[model samples]
Target: MSTHDVKHRLRQLRGLPERVRALEAEVQENRQLNRRIAELTDIVTELLIPLEARDRDKVAEILERYKQGL
Candidate 1:
């Protein structure tokens, strides 16, 4: 290969580690957001049963727990 091509590739390689670290941080943030969404989904699912049954106490309790979690 030409020296110019070799030098270009080397420059790109030097930047890869920083790019990888930025991507890792983005992935970590996405994971945490996904986990929070799952938890909220579970809480909503749990709340639905009590709400359908017209059980005020159970609904209140579930809401209290959800609030405390936040």
Candidate 2:
């Protein structure tokens, strides 16, 4: 093609790597966030089990341990 077209294409190609890096970083961040959500969900479900059983002592103990962990 023409020189101008070639230069434009070259600039676009050079930008591709930076864009890919940003996208990859976003994907990794999303994975970490998803994992955290899953962990919290598990903890909540565990807490619910004791509550559903009307186990006040177990629930309190779990809450205290969880608070200390934070």
Candidate 3:
């Protein structure tokens, strides 16, 4: 309606693309972090079960798998 309002809207629109890209990058980072956390959780659980049963061979296997993942 007003000149000032129109200019302000245009400025906001100009910045929108950069803001969207930033948000997309942040989302990708979060996904990667979540995937890593899940992998770690699985490794811990595998180690715990083998260790509880005193299965050295199984524990070693699990550790090797974790190393390979890294």
Candidate 4:
């Protein structure tokens, strides 16, 4: 009805595009970070593959020795 009201509504509509772009950018960044996390987890899992054992005592002993200055 008024010039000011129309201008305010247009500004709000224009702001929606900027907000959408920001959300899209954040989604892309999250995807990349998730991929990196998976890669690092796999690498660490591979490195520690030999450390997994059915023997609890062996794991405990190793930790104890490490805590008591080797």
lDDT values for all models: 0.83, 0.83, 0.83, 0.74
> Which numbered prediction scores highest in TM-score against the true structure?
3
In angstroms, the error of model 3 at 61 is 8.3
- Cα lDDT tens digits for candidate 2, 3-70: 99999999999999999999999999998998899888877776655566667787688778767865
TM-score of 2: 0.61
Tens-digit per-residue lDDT, 1-70, candidate 4: 7999999999999999999999999999998998899877865564345347646787676556545751
Rate residue 46 of model 4 by lDDT. Answer: 46
lDDT of 1 at 25: 99
- TM-score result, candidate 4: 0.53
- How many angstroms is residue 11 displaced in model 3 relative to the true structure, after the best TM-score fit? 0.1
The 10-residue segment with the lowest total lDDT in model 4: 42-51
How many clashes (backbone N, Cα, C below 3 Å) per candidate? 0, 0, 0, 0
Give the worst 10-residue stretch by lDDT in candidate 1.
46-55
TM-score of each: 0.61, 0.61, 0.65, 0.53
Model 3 lDDT tens row, 4-54: 999999999999999999999999999899888988788677665556766
Q: Which residue pairs of candidate 3 clash?
A: none
Off by over 4 Å in 2: 48-59, 64-70
lDDT of 3 at 30: 90
Which ranges of candidate 1 are over 4 A from the true structure?
52-70
Model 4: pairs clashing at backbone N, Cα or C within 3 Å: none
